[model samples]
Target chain A: MKKALRTIIFVTTDADAVAAFNAYFNPNEVQISHFTSGMGAIQYVKQIGEADLLILEEHIKPLGAVQTIHYLKDNMNYSGGILFFSDSDKNEIYTDNEAFEVLKKGFEKSDLDRVLGLLSNKKKPVELNSKPYSLSYLINLSEGDDIFIKESIKIFNESVGKRILEIEELFEKEHYKEVSNLAHNIKPSFEMLENNLGSKICDELAHSQVDSSKLEQIKLLRDEYMNVQECLKQDFPELFKRV
Target chain B: MQRILIIEDNPMVVRSLEFKLKKDGYDIVVAEEGRQAMKLLHEEIFDLILTDLMLPFVTGTQIIEHIKKNYPKIPVIVLSTSTQEDIITDAFKMGVDDFITKPFSPSELSLRVKRTLSKL
Candidate 1:
């Protein structure tokens, strides 16, 4: 009998990602567990550190990605393949680990099929879908130079509301530890666009200490981030190129 | 030939960088941690430093700050996948010469290294 290759997947939305994975990933080689909650995922990885593959997501805590992955690995004494999947796949796509990101975004269904087929048959990388240099979006970015700025703005307009809603929910649930993490996660895109106002708001909300103060900071910051996004959409149509 | 130091844990990235720099006729040295990197600075002088931000025991920023405080002439460039603003700003505050996001082209990296070396 073939040995089972255990996989611990910290997932949030199934929409199509789970289905895609299920369609692929050999049953004999892959035994996978999905976690809807971030804390629960961490607990499982801690209690059972036998996973051979780890799929992480940024939905649980906004910017808790690098920190969470490191912490989980440290606590569990787990060292294996790691993949990060984020629903917020607007413009940012990891290049070095681009193949994994491709899988996470449900982009390369055929490659995933090949991976499953190889794993099921106990094949090596020789027969699998091998990429020449991890598939990166920088290649895409060069082509999308004209559209990149506009597309970025559109993504900002669409995601800002959802980001604020998520943060508010986290606050309501008293996930105080995650406030800064979430802000940090969102701050990058804002900073990349030189959105100083939005960046400042995220910075303040991330570091606030008191209860009411934190809430107030979040509320004020959320508005600022949102307003900057909207104003960019309206005020600077020439520079931002709103879609 | 200019003295160059690489502080990165990932062997693949290091090897890739080494190939590009060597082809350009620059002398290079590499280290994986902050403390070991600091030790190398004591023995040989480097014109430029290319470092990754996230590292075990010793961080890229710590190394950059050490170089700035003691050597002052060597310029440090931070290479990271991390997009955190504070980390980027902190590196500059500690006197980092340039910051580049990860998955950069080896040619582009080589060009930046040349530019930094020329500046010194």
Candidate 2:
């Protein structure tokens, strides 16, 4: 017996887009459900409880593409891939770990096929390495100046260390706004250390709405910082001694 | 020596900027926040301003507006994250001289500073 076809939720009011999608996808491989508004598409997905992918147009009634994606991902916990259709001239959309891909309007069939292939492939779980931080960025910025590197490391230890403590305290006090600002302020430190997990947490903490999840994020950041600091201390025994 | 004022709250970034620009032969003065930056602007005459958009106490936008009005001759360069496209656009509209994205190359910043100063 043939396997069930994968369902795709295409959200758009454009007749041309629907026709293009219908023409490109093989009926045997996938089934397409069309909706004119974000709300309608969202309702359909909620009712079905799952979809293989969601294709969103840049403009739609009731809610825009971004809002729809957020509602689906954040509120509904939708796990399917998302393809956003946007104008060629608009600012590119970036998400942490690239949760969605963007295809410019009037995209060719080949582009659609490529994106579909990518979306269908399951991403491999990223292996966490032993060392989650690096000094390469700082080293390069220093241009082999040991003094600058040492000073920067010291500054990171003093400032970032203190900020992490403050973030935890603020979160405990339920000062979510201050917690967010502190996260925003220290984001560059993680970027400098080349710590992706820490950076992503900071981005989430900075942008996401206030919630209990923030405390969990703060703990993660704190643990990561401690790990990085421990490694740094081991690597630079003399520096730690000086401190 | 041409002097530049860096108005940023990030110590790491401030250190990098200070290290690079000072090596490039420009005198550097640092302000850890926007209010201090505004006060420093009045007390000193700088050739250029390097500021971050998000700041404590005051904002880069307010500082830029003040510069355009009071110190129009001193060209301003903004330091922003790549994700802040809309805010960067507003900075340009407000008459900033140029912008360097965070995690920016020190060499590129040196060149931009040199170029911005040359145009004056």
Candidate 3:
């Protein structure tokens, strides 16, 4: 059997879209981290590291997909793949040759499938221990009203619940390697739920908080996450339907 | 508080305007792309529009056209990095109230915001 390749992926879209995307990419080794919005994606990637691929929508309302792409590519130093989607364009906005080229060329949509194929072609199966992390989902989910975004929290809280426990066990083992890898992997999970404790845990793993100070920070973060888990379990048991 | 809509792409420029305008107590809404800027107008009414010439998704000119056709009550000012005569004339023809270029002092943005808000 071929050894699996370890890679990081970041995505932003609706919860349903995210769930669908996971079936396709099957990211990381042990767990999968997912995100919801463009800002949340940018923050997660900037704080952690580069993602192997970025699956985005071409027509996210309120914040145009192209403009957010500008912010991500320009400010974040993202070298990941860019995948975009748009609803059947009612206006036929890109019918003009000039418009088509700008959309196709500037956004680098041309290189998409090839990137995906190459990623999939990596042949090695995913690491059983790899986790998917993405936070952009929260930002994307938080449109229209607070209810929509809150729904994202409820959904992601469930998705990441068990994995949080598994990682906590790994962390207690002083398995710094696993902790660092898992931290980098699940950074998106903490972000989508706005689980500040999860963020602090991932932050230390993602960044340079090595000594005693970082350890204490992680412990504090773990406590906070325990509270967040309780809150999520008690509130909104049904969770919002995916869009 | 008067409502102002700013459609600009560059963050540095956006932050600069945001800083000065907030100090003046204006309720500001921002859009980095023309398409997004237009969507905002559909829901909220702004007193004045301070737009840039170039934007992603939809151009600044498109914004002017949409606003002209729909929200004629709102005055518009074009504060962009472009000073091309055709751009100016076109914007003016589209009913943009004023056109100013960037590298301008903070006072200039304050003045233009004041002028446009005052005229409205």
Candidate 4:
């Protein structure tokens, strides 16, 4: 027997949105509940247990998307994925995390289908040869400008390399606290690129715990940085001069 | 055209916001850190302020405090990734007009800016 679609809690004040959702997803296929207010939705979830997915409308009056997500995450400790939908041009604020996605009012059923498919799959699809260069950061930052992409890559190539050297010098001087803070700051950039090795090294260096072998963590971070640099040089040969 | 100041450290965010706001015909000035923002606030008059909560040299709260004390006439909006309730509550108490979180859509930001300006 095939498994049933996950339960989805669709929270919204808009009548049209509710109608759209009802028309799209069959009730029998997936468990669905509709709440008109953020507080109401929260209460429903609290009464039962967690919903597999939360489809939140950005403009839910007194509770809104930000406050609702805040309460759910901070107070309730709800860990399910969230899909934010907005009918207007109001900016929806959210972090770039594994369980978060956004959809606009005009999105069709296919868009919702694609997002739902991704959310249902436990394992994320891997990109081919992601190790050579983590391009997602630039892809987002540049937004498809060829010149802008090239310039950003060049700047990252120069600035990140310099910062790595600075971190090494700081480590050599035994300024561990400074190293920790610096690593903490740089870790987000690596994480955005999906470079797990670089992010892991940074996390190890940033930890407040002190050990005799902590310098080894810095050395590992340095090696990871070199690998990234080499990868960039090899992939974008025109951007870097032969050393 | 309305003149606005953007105080943010992230270069990507700055570029995106500046592009959209400028296209909407707002005159803009940018500062990459809290101290630079302070300097700009003193040197020029602005209709509104958009700032990130986490900044170097000075924190966003400190900047908001300074604005409330001296530039109380200007409306302020916060754009940050901080999820702390105390931080946000404190900003509202200090008289910030609005709050937005990071990774927000540009269209949404533009609309908020327009609405806030219209209210002012």
Candidate 5:
């Protein structure tokens, strides 16, 4: 009989971290899901009934890592391994029995491997079939509901093109703040779709100063996103039939 | 059913709040701006109001003022990212019942909302 794959949920607001995490685990046997907000992660945990292992980034927006930990423990009674990754030297610590483990962000893969080893004794390499511009991330988000995946992709295809244009125009107008807000607003959509380049570019644009150089990057990202969507439609015509 | 008026501009936050509150059996009404909230307030009565301080057209403070004048008995909860000590203190003085910061836990926010409504 085939062994069941372990499910891992990671919550972080950082787009780059999501890309790295997704790429690192692409060839593994474990099932991984990403949430951009702590609250979303909490809701997923509550709905799903339990968590096997949860990795949380401290700087996650709308709810930081500490609060997420408190909620998981107090509200959901989540007693799983929670790997807390952060950059600051707060020097704070949680007792082991609380099931909270702290690790510094930006560590190498081996560092994470060691941490994973500490968390579970039966860590197996689970394989996930991932392709560039694949809908695997959206599939995970929708829990394999093809209809939801279809709608999400359709919406993304329709909106992102206009959003990219607006972002570029706003940057050209020297409306740095508006550019940042728009970029911040759309970054999650890209992250959810596993469009790493779009997510990464948006993150930078959100923090970027008002400069002409920014438009070039935005233009390049737009072309890439347009190409990815075209490829997606071509690759899965039936899935994106209405799109 | 207890009705809640959520005054928030962010669609993601609004959806999260609406989903969680709806799941808990509350009738949820959403207004994307302060003006829209005021319009809703004029047309309908809500048991409670949850608002973010920074809003368009009118402000959360202005909304509070309107509520105090027209519907003095209704409870209000302020949810925002503002760390200005005076803003929070002023809200309390202006009859705001509870204050929760951004990125709040959904369950915790629900508990606070429940506690605040229990008085009514």
Candidate 6:
């Protein structure tokens, strides 16, 4: 029988940290839940009952990391392996507890791999086919309400579809800041649609400096958005029909 | 009916939020930009405010500061895609009542809105 993938709950408010973890972990091997605050992590734990591990930043707030760890262990009876991310010199503060391991800030992939290996046995990797875009997330968000799904699609078509054109014009005018802002604004729409390629392109565009490379990214995002839009129209003909 | 002023420029997000919150039966008013939100804030009273951190004409932080100083009783909830700790911490320190990340679950949205309003 195949074993279940390990669940890792990562608590941090750093976008870079979240991006790093997302890039490192194989989805088939580990399922990760990210939360911005320790309280958010606690709420998730309360909902799911337990996870295999909890990785948190030393500076997590609302409830600090130490207090969060205590609440999870004592009040929630959580027995998961806990990992703390702190400055290399500050490892001594957490080293006192033998149960917890400290990861230095900006730890590399090998460091993460070593820590995971210590916590659990490695499972054989499996291959799976995944789509570039999926409405499963949107369907779930709508709770199977087709009307809401159709409306959201229409809104995406009208809003994001229009904004991309404006972004192109803004880039031409050298309004790099506006171009970046526009990318930041439409990013969530791509995420909501589960268009990872488009979302990733938007993330890059959101931070890119004024250069020819930024235009290349915008073109890529446009192509991806167009592809997703085409797919959505075909998948939901009724939704796309003239109203 | 409890009133919620939603300050967001994204039509897709606005539609989703409006759909769910209306189904939950709150009187919803939307402001596409921070300036419009400020005008509405001065003209009519709201029980709660659901605002995006990024907006045109005025920023969410500036709007929150205005609300904290002028309309201290109205509870504000921030909607953001930013995962930056300093921004989130600053919003809380500026008197934001709650924070909801984007691409949020509808069930969670319902629950958070209910929870925030119940505190009134």
Docking class of 3: incorrect
Question: Could you give the candidate ranking by DockQ, starting with the highest?
Answer: 6, 2, 4, 5, 1, 3
TM-score of chain A of each: 0.37, 0.46, 0.38, 0.49, 0.48, 0.49
Error of 2 at B103 (Å): 1.6
Q: Label model 2 with its docking quality class.
A: acceptable
The positional error of residue B28 in candidate 6, measured at the CA in angstroms, is 1.2
How should the candidates be ordered by TM-score, best one leading?
6, 2, 4, 5, 1, 3
Worst 10 residues of 5 chain B by lDDT: B101-110
Cα DockQ of the candidate 4 complex? 0.09
What are the DockQ scores of the candidates, in order? 0.01, 0.28, 0.01, 0.09, 0.05, 0.29
Two-way TM-score contest, 1 vs 3, winner: 1
What's the TM-score of candidate 4 when only chain A is evaluated? Answer: 0.49
Model 2: CA > 4 A from native? A1-130
Taking all chains together, the TM-score of candidate 1 against the true structure is 0.36
lDDT winner, 1 or 6: 6
lDDT of 2 by residue, B1-120 (tens): 999999999899899899988978999999999899999999998999999999998988999999999999999999987778999999999999999988776546866899999999
User: Model 5 over residues A12-109: C-alpha lDDT tens digits?
Assistant: 65556666665665455444566766765676665443445677887778887778878878887886667777775643456445435566667689
Off by over 4 Å in 1: A1-243
TM-score, cand. 4 vs. native:
0.56
Specify the highest-TM-score model's number: 6
Compose the digit string of candidate 3's lDDT tens values, residues B1-120: 899898986543455566568867999899978888988999898898888866657878988999999999999988653325678888998889997665334334666778777875
Clash counts for all predictions: 0, 0, 26, 0, 8, 0
Which residue pairs overlap in candidate 6's backbone?
none
In model 6, the runs with Cα more than 4 Å from the true position are A1-130, A208-210
As a whole number from 0 to 100, the lDDT of residue A45 in candidate 1 is 51
lDDT of 6 at A68: 85
Which residue pairs of candidate 5 clash? Answer: A28-A126, A28-A127, A29-A125, A29-A126, A29-A127, A30-A126, A62-B103, A63-B103
